[model samples]
Target: MPSFLGSLRQFVLAPKLSAVTFAERGFPGAGSAAAERLEAIPQAVVCGFEWGIAARDLWEVERRLELVEQEQRGFAYEGAAMAFTVRDAMAGGRGTRTRDLLLGPAAPHLLLAYIGIGFAMARLPRPLWRNIMPDLTGTLFYPTMTWLAVDGYGFDLAYFHPEKYIGKQRVPPPYPWEGRPDYFPRAVDQGIGRALWFTGGAEPETVTASVARFPSERRPDLWSGVGLAATFAGGASADGLARVRDAAGEHWPQLGLGAVFAISARVMAGHVPEHSALACEVLAGSSVDDAVAIAGRTGASPADADDTMPLYEQWRNRIRAELGAISGEQRKAS
Candidate 1:
């Protein structure tokens, strides 16, 4: 009976704990993977935290992460951010990291780290948090990351500061590429679209309503962000995915395609957290196998999943060519 109990214990704990290895990647003595792996640390920590909370048996999951929190604290800003994310997740976003750092001094990469905090926020009961955005003084990826925060934390644009958007109607500072007339507003929409996917709990109408507010030309980019959120963290059902896919319209294939790539990249890194896997499974269905084939077709294997972004860009270019058109091109030509 004791042996059987021990086996049952292992079965219950192993999958949840497995993600910890990914979470631990960037700490000291975690080796070369640490340096190359920092970009993925936020995802790892949040996923690990979420899995632990949602585990079959949650008796000691939070307690087990205490040491991880301490270990993550010892690293630099990213490490600190990861530590804070884990601690906040364990504490259900009531954790003090935001009061200590988010509302105060934070490195630029730390802003990226805050995105992880938002991930934890998405998983917590909505009653636990209200208006978590802090005074973000510097101009980094603040616009993009703020949306990430809103989505992960379940906040509305009303909760976002009005002062930040008071400037001229030009694009926001953190344009992913170059200057565009409405680029900033579009990015904001993308962020809001992402938030809507989370804020509406991944409902198709939420994404649709948010996208409708944007100009028709800008909807696809906004939907791209929506697709990402829906697939990466939405926890949508089959009907939900079908609704999302249908709502995506001309963007559906690309959205589903991107979902596959996102999952495949995680798989390449050897960290198939259940949330991401479920996302891919629901979005791509049988196309997931196709995505795996496409990911490998380039004959390039990134040492880390974070390394796959550029490769994905390359793949996107190839896909666009195969589709016989360019994405986001009509506006540029105009």
Candidate 2:
């Protein structure tokens, strides 16, 4: 007994765009344009908010790590407790239903957030719920929405895994096998096979490639906006903030605006104060080397090293350096 408005919400939120168009096209002003496109694209509007939450969580985790490392006393237990809470919440449910509901209508939105922002965040690899919750919530949300749309509203989109339909359908035997003992059963299997067949040379390749290409293994640029967002959302230490700022500055100068947007969104979401000057400080100046130096000094401790120094930072740095080198060559030629 789903309501019409509920059905409409779910349908409008599903992902539905070609890979070539969404990923490879590289539209001018991709950040702002992409944000607008995402807003307009049905389900994508919620992505920024999800990513903001992730950034905040990661920032909190890093902050706790820094505190445990530095204080080694009363704060250590608190830090551990905080970290455990994030893990537990992620493992169980931290507004998962709400997130699913928000993203239910948009398939591409979920995909893009998972492959693009989620992968970039590296929250998918860890066992902690904080890392895995977004993906799991997204997975459930999309399928449920699809089920509702098809079963309740009579839409014709195919399911992600068609195997679930095997026992639901009955079919006649094929060819001369009609009289054979196994013919009827075999025909049913054949129907299932037909349903599962992919006539196209390959399933549309988007998320897999994006995930594969993720720069999780490298050092991130300090200036990338995700880092900035993480900082303003609170729970990050001064040192963590410095690392994020440095990483963004060193690696993702172009993404500075996006970082600002992320911070703004966090404030708007009520996760942080509305007018924090930290956002402005982090976004100011061309001090990549200085920021990197600060991060090296502050974030070089054992705990920071253990967690791999923020996946977002690693990715931003790697992408920025490569892009910078390419831009350098172009500038040299000019």
Q: Which residue window of length 10 is worst by lDDT in model 1? A: 161-170
lDDT of 1: 0.44
- For each candidate, give its TM-score against the true structure: 0.43, 0.24
Residues 1-334, model 2: lDDT tens digits: 2246433533443223332122323322233432233212212222222222333343442343333221111112222222222333444545343233224322222312222222211222223322332434324322211111111000011112222232233222222211233322322232222112111111112211221232442212112323333323232334444554454344444334323333433333333342224533443322333333323332222233233323223333443344455446767999
Clash counts for all predictions: 3, 29
**RMSD each, Å:** 15.7, 23.2
Q: What is the lDDT of every predicted structure here?
A: 0.44, 0.29
The candidate scoring highest on lDDT is 1
